[model samples]
Target chain A: MVNKSISEINNRIKDGSVNVVTAEEMVGIVAELGAQGAAREVDVVTTGTFGAMCSSGVFLNFGHAEPPIKMQKVWLNDVEAYTGVAAVDAYIGATQVSETLGMEYGGAHVIEDLIRGNTIDVHAISPGTDCYPRKILDTTLDINDLNQAIMLNPRNAYQKYNAATNSTSQKLYTYMGSLMPNYGNVTYSGAGVLSPLSNDPEYRTIGTGTRIFLGGTQGYIVGQGTQHSSKSGFGTLMLQGDLKEMDAEFVRASTFTGYGVSLYVGMGIPIPILDEKVALATAVSDADIITQVMDYGIPTRDRPVVRGVTYEELRSGSIEIKGREVTTSSLSSFKRSRQIAGILKDWISHGEFFLSQPAERLPSDTVSKPMKQTRGTAMVRDIMAKDVMTIHKNASVFDAAKMIMDVSFNHLPVVTENNILVGIITAWDISKAVAQNTFDLVENIMTRKVITATDTEQVTIAARRLEQHGVSAMPVVDEQHHVIGIITSDDISMLFARRN
Target chain B: MKIRIIINRDIVTKPILAEAIIETGIPLNIAQAHFDSTTGEIIADIEDTEYRMIKNALVSRGAEVLRLDTPINWDEEECVECGGCISVCPTKVFSMDEEWNLKVDTTKCIQCGTCIEMCPHDALSLDV
Candidate 1:
């Protein structure tokens, strides 16, 4: 049974009667303390949402066996009777538990309330779960006993977290199904892990596990065609060059089209770059053009011309000119004029017909150029520093500050024995802790929440992640939560220079 | 020499008529009226030969040709008080009889078969 109220919890913290714990061992320690009436509220902070889910599962399953009260809303004195079970199973069964316990499962809101109410006597935070844990714990706990727990199964940590927090039911089931390795092995799969669905094209797999069948087609225009004409009355002109040349031309054309379309369509619609041009006319001898016009009894413009029109307007018959109907024949003629103008422009610029131009030779016989490399590439391994300095949850803030200065490092990766990244402690955190005069414990000064990257990721991705999150540095970790290296803005700057 | 080829054949076969509504404005039922198989000439009630190119393109891609006919025009006065044209038109070209006996919203009409089939008064007939 819980004995202390919100005010009494604060009083215990003020008098130094209660000590904050951040380790798995603190689970039993705080439970015992709570039972002994050391303080009514025992705040449990985990590393992240995943850590919170896993720890909450363990606390609810194991701590509830002793009937430990899990604090919900500290201000409202709302408490839920917990049951001890594995974090994964507990998270999966959270909805059922909420329904059975008649409690509102408001995700991280419940955790937030517990911290604000100062009911949390101990916080067991997992490193990569929530966005902020250090701030929450520092405000509530004694900050000295904040120990990190390295869990054996981090995938289970993620699965349990996602299952409890994600809103989509189908996504939850898909995640659970993915966890099944074989029979009942219960292997956990990470998020965004891809797997083959089915071989049959008739029933195609769409989004992850979702599948849809191929349907039959119907229409008058079954296939599309390119419309081109020759002004020389020959009907055939070199419309497209060799594949490579055509591809290069297409790239340039696409760039122009993208810019033009973006200007016309605005930034919202992503317009695809088109390679093929709508040829309105082919190059014709001046004599043939005059003869053809006379033979066809058609009116001729002063300048010899051919036309081209976009395929979209042709199919839809939706193009209009100043509130007047543009017939296909008229459009074809107009396109011819534009094509002629384009060809004339190209000819005038190059001093030759664009179609008849010879390809330029490559400088393959020339000596290979020497490349200038940056510091990051010159000393890739040295730039990747290892054995990063860290501080324990229970270490004194003064000691943590001394260690930071001693190691000549600004940031430290907080982790447990099993090598799970728990949190990050920075010089700034220590400074804040010193300013607040809470330097007595590491938990009080050390940042309990941290942004981290995986070791397998590229430094560019790491840099982008840092930029996106507005962080100066990040701890690189392995799947087992072991800190491998620390990435900083300096390293990223070198990487950017090398790339450019 | 400009050779005028008359194709008296169905532009779209029955099997693929449903898709014709979305891909081409010509309805599956109406596509049959535009072609003349005997003369081998298509007197298509299309606005012009652009539709002919579209039909030829479709046929070249394995769509079977059947018959062709001129498109139908609706008599505004004789059109029944029923609003079947409004509901049946795929493009929603027709509306309720307000100022006139029957109003045709020509802009929205895509020449699908629904409005022609649903009209009970037989007031609507081929324009060409």
Candidate 2:
């Protein structure tokens, strides 16, 4: 039941008597001392993670142009920056590719170059207005020339994430790195027990305004990150820091083979062990934290989970999948992560850093949901043509061929006297009729077993039916078997075009 | 000393390496090898003193041999030691020490270029 406030810990740190340890060290300390004893002895536990985070970006305030142009479009070193905000203020996303260099260079590269004190080419355009009347401006500037450069990541440290493996025969190039064909390898990204969010799984001390170490400089947790799902054990953190104070060694740019560029960020957080529960939470080991291994080969919103595995198993360099042993690799840097944690621990022990109580706690029960799609709801009646060309069974083959040739139609429905669909004929069928010398009637060459589409069927289902039956068109019918209309692959494609 | 030998299609099916080993009477440790219908590549480690003898024997057998003095270059300054090369390297060239520090054993590298291609920092290269 030992309890301590952040202010008390700060006072102790100021007195040069505070005890702090890294999350990795704290695991052994807690195991030896137990949670209650550890809470009484330890003051803080620092956690860290260094991994590729694509949702990270920096916002820059480039002061103002000579004539004060409202930058509608902007590019830094040929990489585009989002100018949808205020004038002269732009956000460069990490994954945005370069117009000239493509994926070989990107916004992440520009950020890295700026951090390294390299000059960057700044290009901008504006639809000139009276208040801000500059048409185009191109200039070179470095990190020192900017008014403000802030790194505001929407999502940075994931608490834990699924491991990725490919099940397909061909190699897969993805944000997960290059997955070898036929499960040749497995790639996982996380700092495991050293991760910040994993130490504060319930977000007890990690929330809005919580101080953190961002890329070698002190930063703050802005809020719960995008897609933060603590219920499923994949919590994330949104962060903000001053890019000017960051070290180039802690921030890097990476280009995934077929995927675009992403920023590899080094981040750390100091968890104040206020109570026994907090101490126990920080004691979580790799074996205690479990995550699923997903098959990235499916390429769907819901990739199939191959199996549940612990971080200890993933870190062992190999794991069993479907009765086959597969080698595992890591995209996140554990060495760098340990270094970050150690640095933070030293800062706190020297009283150079102090933790802050969160203004608000993050949600612990939320789950990330898939995007709701509207395209699959379209019915066959919405895209089918009502004016269907039909031929009677008693009609001559020449008449059927004439109707199909005149409209450039590939298929024609053969119906009875009451206009009920009984068979279907194609231009190929007429050509066969000529080759076989059977030019008497349409029924002689028509396919009697017609694959028909109901008016109420979904457009996607109708398209699948067309593919399954190997037909170009299908006659839409009513409950009474009346040929109401026709659906073709072209019509479905046009509908897709319109929707897109 | 480690060397990589490439046997062409004309003599790929023949036992050139075994014949060379017998002729030189030098124990050769075959670390890795890959064979296709057109060609075959074999990487083996042998004693440094017998390097010339094996080279002559392999050359006499019409097999192209190259000394793997520097198969890959690691830029420690740029590398964050992400372990992205551990699984892709067929020979387990990269590993984590007990302290979780990255350790690289270039002796096991087959020069397959998989690690160089997969490195996010562009730290690993075959330029050497």
Candidate 3:
């Protein structure tokens, strides 16, 4: 049963004599008890993760005909490779498949398939949709003199939807240019070339006239434009722009594929670890319960030993039983001897020998002994204190202080009308609230959450709760939200001291 | 004279009694018993030659004999056919039966709870 009063359990626990058994110990105890005529009622307690993972692994291993898409191998081709559009489409398609399958979503795979494809007209293709085409020159152009230029003109840059896929397409242009110049081995001429007028319409003046020619200008300019074209053409006519369209499709598909693969492998593994932790926690709890039951005593039947001689044998002065010789000559007082003989007679009559003392007892003063100490089987109601103080959600600060002073408690439980524990109003909390004047109502000043303990819990558990919450006191309550007792730090200290 | 008493089992009041005897300063006779050994039986029967000294030593040590003489019998037929009691018994008084039921190798059963709890037929009982 859940201990409602945290303080009381904590007190017993602090005394250092509470029985806290782990799972392995419980198993031994259960076996021992079963041997001693008691039925084992071992119940396994755990969080859900262990079972979940076992189920998941089983399902993954056996449920599917083929390996799940997450583990499936996908391949990408050249057009999909160049613009990376194919990867993106594959990613989106995989997401759709995952949603349709009702299985946990895993990502897609993107493999860069480098295949040979011909370069097409740049003006007809879409940006980021068509693969970037290369212009392979048969001969290297003069590095100093070549001026390369590219121009693109598209009918539209923004088209929301097309009948082909009902997906929007955004067009954009990018321009890149570079220049290289070479100037070397120059000679200046001044005589005939600079002559004043010999059949030349223009003649150079005589004073230091010189002519010079400069060479070598090399650069390239790149530009692009996109037009929004809805595929209204049918059959053969549609084949006209298939190359550019396919290039665009590959770019989108490639992007989706890469994204899908990443989501499946990288993000899915950690999600299941949380479930594993839950299972571990449950196993530990079961072990603890088993240990507790085993430590309790097991019952056994009686075995009686007898040592006696009949009256006739005594009179004859000779007796023997089980190959042991009997000597009865030391009887100084006949009556006393008869009394001793009579006691032996009784043991023999019952067909059992009774040993007057216990054969073995555990050492009373050892650490292990204390650890195995059992708290009597008393329910929480047996130890719970009924006098409890509670505060409402909207109570005022003054009202809270008055309640605290009246009850002489360091902390007060604050519950809603429905009896749920919404918060706690400790003296420290109240003092802070009052000092700041930041909140007018108790709800504003009160701690919105508080750790609680049940009535049926052991004092050891209560002490642990206290330590875990780092609180000096906690309120004990029943199922119906009624406060039963208040356990304090001092109570735990006294309980621990007394137990020692 | 100083004397030491070695008990075969963990006795609760032995140390207190020992201290009391030491303060009295009486001639002591020491008897030692191996409690933690395989056979946890007390071998307190000192030889007649050393009886006087042993008696004096026990008195000096404040060793009170709680039980001096008691007749113990083992019922062979009533013995349950289980061997668990043998394991926990300090004195090796009981042994297992090779042929029939749980036979008491009276030489081995120290009468510990091990066998008593182990017997499923409710057979083994202690004559205390």
Q: Which candidate wins on TM-score?
A: 2
lDDT of each: 0.31, 0.91, 0.30
Residue-wise C-alpha lDDT for candidate 2, range A1-500, written one tens digit per residue: 89999999999889989999999999999999999999999999999989999999999999987798999999999999999998899999999999999988898899999899999999999999998999999999999999999999999899998999999876878888889998889999999999898998888778899999998999999999999888998888899999999998889999888788999999999999999899999999999989888999875578999899999999998999888999998999998999999999989998899889899998899899988886468899988999998999989999999999898879999999989999999999999999989998998889999998899878887897799678889999998899999999999999889888
Model 1 lDDT per residue over A1-500, tens place = 33333244334434554322222222344345433332233321111011111112111211221212332212111222231332211221111222222322321222332222323333322232233222211123311222311111111111111110111121111212111111111111111000001010011101111111100100011111111111121110011111111111101100010011000000000000011010001111111122110111111112222222232232222223334433211101111122222333332233231111113211112222344545443322344567677666667778778898899888877767666777788888888877877757766555666877766555655665688678888887777778888878787787667668
Every model's DockQ: 0.01, 0.56, 0.01
Model 3, span A286-353: residue lDDT tens = 11211000100111111122232222232222234235432211111122212222332233223232
Number of the candidate with higher lDDT, 1 or 2:
2
Off by over 4 Å in 1: A1-382, A497-500, B1-128
Q: What is the lDDT of residue A180 in candidate 2?
A: 91
Write out the backbone clash pairs for model 2: none
Cα error of candidate 3 at position A154, Å: 84
Residue A268 shift from truth in candidate 3, angstroms: 36
Fraction of native A-B contacts kept, per candidate: 0.00, 0.77, 0.00
- How do the predictions measure up, each by TM-score? 0.24, 0.78, 0.22
